[model samples]
Target: MDQNSAVWLLLVTALVLANLPFIMVNRLFLMIKVESKSFIVNMIEFLTYFGITGIFAYLLEKKVMGHVAPQGWEFYTIVFFMFMIFAFPGFIYRYNLRNYLHKA
Candidate 1:
């Protein structure tokens, strides 16, 4: 495979590997537990969990990508976009689909 194809494969592989459980099961689990809570409470709980995960991912990347090199704004911009992309599914789940999918 060409370099571009290989890179795309790796990115897709990593995203699916990382996100499948969160998409299929973890959200279900959280919804069950958080259903009794207020929306803001649930949102804070969810965001805190993900924020910590993001911090850990950032730290791991910093180590793996090397510390001596200062990452550019483009790097953070990409990460910000990634965070938004990763959040889209959950946004749909909680805001758009939660009430429809699981009746109170």
Candidate 2:
């Protein structure tokens, strides 16, 4: 794939993956019932998604850019925030969203 296409693919993948924890925790969009997960479990799942996405992003960087750039703390901070942003939809679903949909 072209660099541009690859970049878009990575971004979309990251967004989906980042929200997975919230989905699984809230038992949203599942075919079978899952027990509600505790806050600690949810947080762990969030961090796990972060790590997996980080690795995937790094690999994409290496493949598309031909080198892995040295990242500082700032890089990690930005990525964390981005992951949080991506998780917003799932958060809404777990909290405010379901309420609204049911009342609709």
| Candidate number of the best TM-score | 2
Once fitted onto the true fold, the runs of candidate 2 whose alpha carbons sit more than 4 angstroms away are 26-33, 100-104
In candidate 1, stretches whose alpha carbon ends up further than 4 angstroms from where it belongs are: 1-35, 68-81, 102-104
Compute the lDDT for candidate 1: 0.52
Worst 10 residues of 1 by lDDT: 17-26
Clashes in each model (backbone N, CA, C under 3 Å)? 0, 0
By lDDT, the best candidate is 2
Model 1, residue 80: distance off in Å is: 4.7
lDDT of 1 by residue, 1-104 (tens): 35465445545544443333334433433445322444455455555554555565555555555543567999768765675576566557656687688885
Error of 2 at 31 (Å): 12
Question: Estimated TM-score per prediction?
Answer: 0.44, 0.82
